[model samples]
Target: MTNGGWFNHYDDPDEFWDDEPLPIERTPLNPSPSPSPPQNPSSPPQKVVPTPKPVEPQPWTTGPVSKSAGAERLQSGVGSSFVAVQVDAGLLPVHVQLSPQWHRHVDGSEAGAELMRAYQKAIGIYLGETIKSGKYFSGEFRHPSAPPDRRTVLMLLLETASWADYRETQTRIYARNGFEVHGQAQIQNEPVTSMRANWFQVKSIRIWPDWARRADPIQIVDEVLCCANRVRELRPTFKIRGDYSRYSDEDLEYQHLQHRENLIEELGV
Candidate 1:
């Protein structure tokens, strides 16, 4: 064999290829999506509210007042033989009981006068008892020697003057308005009585004794009370029409002192 072509270098072939390294492959990535612009949240709807108002006052109105204790019926008679009279708180006669003996004793013409006398007696007795009970006059007033203080005296005078002025004003108003109310009662087809009243007091009471005598006492009293109540119901409301404004306490006291001095001088006391 030819030595140059046939015989190659075989002793170090594996050792010569052991020093080289291998290459690696990779894929491309997609770009991320742009973030959305920030937005403001809508504000919640708001609630609403409201306001309030005021009140007013009223005026005084007069009407029937409740009767006092033991004021329902007050009766008086003379010796059980004469006539008897029953009256209410205002001393308005409600009933008259005439005995047979009284009717026989009094002449037919004198019956009305005798009944009136009995009514007067009843009023007197009622006033006496009222005074004794300290109801009519509550010891507020005293004799000149034991008079109340100057302030109290002035107050009393002012109150009296105020009441008088009010009464006078009310009277005029009643007259102008024709504020009289009338009520009547009948018994057994006969007219028994007719009552007339104004805002302040009973104006007139006309009774037919002949018809009233025939009716029961209780019935008569009931009729009278009914009439009185009717008058109250029918009484019209009126605005208080008086200059109730009063002088100052100092002025009232000065006037009282002056009056007292004048009285003392005039009486030479």
Candidate 2:
């Protein structure tokens, strides 16, 4: 039953009574501060890149060989050297010709004359058959510098061959010196045992370095065969090299008779 122009209030305590709107309070507009970088609780520690250290080469050791020293001498070849395998001992013998003093004398006091005699015979028979058979040279057959007495050294040189052949030849020569056979039937064997043994060794020597040496027994044989052919071509009939023809058949018969009479008297027959 109350009447008002623009305001009315009853039992409500928080009620607005105005004919116009109330003014809003002004708020200070400050630009929000730039957000700080986000902190990561689980971030890993930074890795450090290591710089490489320069390396120096180790120096050569002059110290003696020992477990404690932990050092070794650097070895090297000085010059040309010969390596010999001992057939009997099965050892490696290094024949280094570093000086003339190391060279052995063939005719020194230590040299055995009997051994030398056997050696010459072996060489002559072996070489002769090789020449006759036509084989290639093994590098071993070289004349080590000859001494003043040519007879003592008996240095014979053939063309160069493999080192192996040289070794085999030396072994054969020594072996022939002490050669012996049980049976006497071999005594009458043609060319003789000594000759056969020597010739066999010569052939064996040719086997080593056949490619490099180009050695063949057939070559030697061919030479001899060709030589014989040439000799036949020159003079078909066999004739003595010397003037043995000067002695007539009658003269030879007389000499034979005289030798027979002397042999009969010496034998008391």
Candidate 3:
């Protein structure tokens, strides 16, 4: 120690300072991620597929039957060129076309008779086809192919007459209780025409000429069918008066059969 001064405590300062600095162990703020293993070069490259979107389901619908697909046409073997008639599946006439040569071969006086003959022939063909296709009922009501016994013949005649009477009664009932309904046609939100129906038939129709010219034929048919369906729904509401008022269709049919049986018993046939 010297007066007012500090002294170094090393035996040799040069020997302590002469040694190389030791390597420092330090940590970085952000470390690098570990590398992935290398893939095999011979292997095929993996495909990157996109995720599929969900599909929405579609609604089901039915379309109306086409006329050409539903109707059948036949040529009646009458006149020189013959008459062609088109009918639907239910044997309701759709169209009747007369050839130009019809008048040439058929006289004006006999034209009506010839036309009826043609209609009969076409109807016969239709019935034959229906029977062949097994669509016609092969029930007890079917006509016998061979000659029938006296009792069978009598029964057939009675049945025919009974059915005729039943139809006549139905017609009379309808005539008595017939009520009219009105239907209207619209074009572009405007009333274009109206139709009046008496029970099952269209009694009268009044169409605006201007609207008729612009109205769609398909729309007209649709409106008419709608009105007809409305009328059909009312058919069951027409009740007969007196004893048959409460009778259902089946009940009326049974009553007719019972009456026929009673007649047969009375005649001993």
Candidate 4:
């Protein structure tokens, strides 16, 4: 109160709480059993209507949904579907439509379409075209916001990525992080040194399909950054490029000689 420009409630701070009495915690007897009001006895005996049993749902075999139902729902476009997974449960087989966060992040990216395609393809391969009555793949993985810095995910991507594109992207990512990657170009034709086997193609829709579908944005960036740093640490040949790294000795010398020649030609009688 003194500093806030408000008058103090009491002149003596000790007087208010010092003499305060504690409240008594007494329990009252005769607790009401039920809160319903007393009913009138004079009313004529009312007829008790029996509740009708609910109609049992038809079996999946007998009750197939019309194809138009799905089309109508999709056309509504009131909400987005982020997660699409094959499910086998209950009598009717169906996919649980969830909005996965990956769909949100990758929707606009050039890779987004590819990711969706991979996810679709995986569903069929993993669970089959028609969802059976059973649990298939559960999107329960607690994907980190960014991939791990351990480069595990990056290595997977690199293994599948086209050698040139993967190498180039890896180099640029490393450079952006203030480092360089060695043997980036050498990776093109050289025996695979990073992984034990090579199965993925550059821009293959199959690279970490489920992972791409579930990982959050933060986890995705984390994986790339962690991998880049790990790669730089592993390869010592990769050096830090200086400002003049782009200019070769030959280029510099030729430029200087041309300048000198021009000066001499201009000055000659």
Candidate 5:
């Protein structure tokens, strides 16, 4: 029974011709290219960080300065009345008042009395006692009792020069003495350089007069007479214009008109 044809097939070691049928052959799995090991992620292309830009600086400006760099020490409010004038006219005596900034002496002494006496003398000279000329001079010392600590404001006239020049000199004097330039007036035909002159007269001398009396007609006449005499002394031969009418009582009234006319002549305005 063991060799009888495929002994009931089940018992046959090799049934039919060789195996049931030839087994199919499989192709080699082409090693999927090893997936390139993910290329090590290429270090994420070295996250190139961008460079920062530079900032520029700006310029700094300063505000207004409170005080002048080299201002002089003055007797406080007294600076307001420190009037100076340059005149073609000769030296003329006049009165002046002391600045309020002058402190009174603590002790009543002879020296103080002497100072007061000198101040009185100055006043007398200003009031035409020393001035024989028709020109009038008048001023009063503010602190006659305390002359030791007081500053004086003198009123003097100049003789023989043009008024224009005189006015300029006066302005320069006060300017050098810490007085600010307030205003300037120009006069035609009277080109005096002195602040006392019409051309360069200060519009308003902002001083609180210690002597509260308004300059009266008598005082004016005396001043004019003294001024005229001063003019004679300055130039014995040259005629001096002693006419007060020539100078306007109010310099502001026609200052602009005068300045404009002068400028028009100078710049063909």
Candidate 6:
């Protein structure tokens, strides 16, 4: 409200700072002629602390991990490596590293689940017509690593499939459309104790990454489908190598027969 601020009476903040005296035309060499007050006996002398200069931060260095003196040694390419998921795409398994971003794309949403089911049914149809003879039935599976907390299935294409001999078990799993059924035929008066049906085994299963370490089969199937579709889109038939022509069933059986004959000749059995 006033023409000048209330602070006009005093010098600016700079004059009062750093023990600096008020502005004058000239600084006198002599001391002021003021009477000295009586010194208090209780006052103690204060020490002046020297200000320290600030230190600059050092630049970061990147090299091989430094090992402690007693650190256990690890072999080369061991302990420091990570495995990315690779689904078979023709010759090589297509690599797909699992990450937070990738996790969103294949979260087994409702749509994805339905699509996977359709693919599964189609694969089933292919296997149903391909495998016929009971002698070709095979039952062997590698134990999965990090078993999924929930049941998950992986639909695979069999390069060479054949039905194996029927075996009886209490497990009533072979009651599906793909499975051939008999109408309660009496075997030997053993009242329906065991169910006899054909078991099919594929000579080759589509390659997958180290599945023992896989935790989610659903994620695996999703990733595999992504890889397969991508490869198929790029190349109509993207196959690096095939074993069907190289090792036919006849050739394998002939080798087995020859090996058995050689063993019989040596052992006289």
User: In candidate 3, what are the lDDT values of residues 1-269, reduced to their tens digit?
Assistant: 52432233465433333344556788887888789889999999899999998853221111122211222222223422445544333332344555655545645444334434544455556654554444444432332222344333333333434545545544534343533343466657765444444432334434455553444544433444444445444443322234443546566566657866765566565
Which candidate tops lDDT? Answer: 1
Reference-based lDDT, residue 212, model 2: 13
Best model per TM-score: 1
* Candidate 4 error regions (>4 Å): 1-102, 105-207, 238-269
lDDT of 4 by residue, 107-180 (tens): 43333343334334433333322223222223332112222332332332233224454446445334322222
Which residue pairs clash within candidate 1? none
What would the per-residue lDDT of candidate 2 be over residues 105-199, giving only the tens digit for each residue? 22222122222233334344434343333331333332221121221111210111333433443343333231111211122352111111121
lDDT-based ranking, best first? Answer: 1, 3, 4, 6, 5, 2
- Expressed as tens digits, the lDDT of each residue in 1-269 for candidate 6 is 53332333267733323344456687688969899787788998658999998863321111122221112121111210122433221222244344433333433232223323333333333332222211113322221121221111110012212111111110122222222222121335422111121222111112222331333544544444443443333332212133444655556566545644554466555
Q: Please provide, for model 5 over 1-269, each residue's C-alpha lDDT reduced to its tens digit, 9 standing for 90 to 100.
A: 35443223455656544334446688777745545444466566557788988753211111112111111111111222222222221222243333332223212122223223333333333332212232222223121111121011111122314446445534433442211221121234431112121121111222112211233323322332344233333321222334433444354335434644554466444
Question: Whole-model lDDT, candidate 1?
Answer: 0.49
Ranking by TM-score: 1, 3, 4, 5, 6, 2
How much lDDT does each candidate structure score? 0.49, 0.29, 0.44, 0.35, 0.29, 0.31
The residue pairs found clashing in candidate 6 are 91-240, 134-164, 134-165, 136-163, 136-164, 137-163, 137-164, 145-212
Better of 2 and 6 by TM-score: 6
Per-model TM-score, in order, reads 0.33, 0.15, 0.26, 0.17, 0.16, 0.16
In model 3, where do residues sit more than 4 Å from their true spots?
1-81, 88-92, 138-269
Q: Is candidate 2 or candidate 6 better by lDDT?
A: 6
- Model 6 poorest 10 in a row by lDDT: 148-157
Q: List model 1 lDDT by residue over 1-269, tens digit each.
A: 52232222465533333433344454447756779766556866456755555532211111112122222233233423467876555555566676656545655444445655666666656654554454545553222122244454454443333344534533433342313333356557755655665444455545566755555545554555666666655544333233434766677778766755554466555
In model 1, what lDDT does residue 70 have?
28
